[model samples]
Target: MTVSSETRGLAVVTGASTGIGAATARELAGRGYHVLAGVRRDRDADAIRGPGLEPVILDITHPDHIEALAARVHEDSQGRPVRVLVNNAAVQANLPIEVFAIEEWRRMFEVNLFGQIAVTQALLPALIRSKGRVVNISSVGGRVAMATYGPYAATKFALEAVSDSLRRELAPFGVEVVVVQPGAVRTEMLGRAIAAAGDLPAMTSEQGQRYSGLVRAINNQAVSSTNAGLPAEAAAKVIARAVTARRPRTRYSVGREAALVHVVRFLPDRMLDRILAAALRPHSAVTT
Candidate 1:
């Protein structure tokens, strides 16, 4: 398991434009690997500017981009090796699962699940050659069901399962697969997700009345809770370990809340539901 400085190859990190992905890219680059910062915009590439950091435009949903990346990797590596892949691009548009838009749900799946697969498949040849590492960035939502965020969590759950299967499948070939489930982190995604949740149309006249109050409570909770979670840089440090550790774990849970949520997942469904309902009850709704 000796990885010499010269032999440590390129580490490809998707969603590297900002947040955890960006931090992870910097962390990896600092650790001596040549880093590819995969982002959807050319401007995103500019964000990763520095020694050993290469910004590559990679919108995971685009086949052309995926293919081009593989070609470029082969050329750059010159048959050396690709030592790591971090699948971190994700979007969360929270709505009650019953009323979630099919199109929006599909879009989340495309980036959260299929995009990860597409990138991995394209890079498999190089990873196998190097016996490299694959770190799938899941979330606490993946381990437990949370109301109003089912669409996003479903994909993370699938990612956790897929990471398990891939770990077994790739073990024979020497590639290691690790799943990193971070709780909430201070990132731009929290604000965007909160805004998206508020934009959903009223489901019913009664629900509309219900929705206004509920949305306010949810937004407040999200703002406060997300603000309280670990910083994206801390999560990125965990991701960096997954990438470069000699024996990376199959699953690494980051943040205290993340661990608590995993415990909540094991509780009886009814009990957990009641706990959430009580915990989330709006302050105004608790009048004597």
Candidate 2:
């Protein structure tokens, strides 16, 4: 049913076309919030059709779209506080740094960081008035880097910094900012990322010949291995908690790899490099 809970108020979930964002929108809807499910395509809008899910076309990377989104939010909320904003839309590209183009780097940051910032900026006033909270869905990449994920990881790491700064700055306004770092989750995004990795520098190139095989293998393994990860619904549950918790934590780590992430964070640089090399090095060249 279309929700009308006065206490739960309105929730805006960006990238709601699929994956964690779509799951999160449904979660918030079940919890009594009127969900604005943002998407880029008409089909995606249709996909999320249901009670409490009002699909809107929102391409966060475009300035005009962001402004229109803000206006729509303002109107739907009827000048009231928007209780939650979930910045869950993002994309990933996997390629060795040498094989990655400069424009690719810009595009990653534009969608993952800058676009998120724009949406938040436009909605800050509503958040402040409602004492609302913001939920940013970052990835384990934000905390740990892996081969062929440099460009994507950079954007997430930058997002972590942004979330930290915004968390402290918004404290006085009663507007909470929380980061939910998910290790991995079962979603269609994994397939798309693996498929897109094919476009990296040609295997005939010097650098590509040295690393492309290993890079593709490792990328495939990373995606396929994580097939056992929690469902996107699990990550959505965490985002929901962050939005509704009376005193939410600054960061919440989801998935079984949280302990591993801690180890990666505290290990010596030399030890960490050795570990990564052992795992990521070309298989035929290694021996016990």
Candidate 2: regions farther than 4 A off: 1-4, 77-80, 200-204, 281-288
Question: Deviation in angstroms for 151 in model 2?
Answer: 0.4
Clash count per candidate: 0, 0
Q: Write the per-residue lDDT of candidate 2 for residues 1-288, one digit (tens) a residue.
A: 534655577889999998899999999988888888999999999999898788989999998988887888778645545898999889887888887788878888889999999999999998898889989988888987877778888999999999999989999999899999988788888777766766654555688678766676676566555687889899899888898788899888889866657688689988887887776655434332
Quantify all predictions' global Cα lDDT against the true fold: 0.83, 0.84
TM-score, prediction 1 = 0.91
lDDT value for model 2: 0.84
Q: TM-score winner among the candidates?
A: 2
TM-score of each: 0.91, 0.92
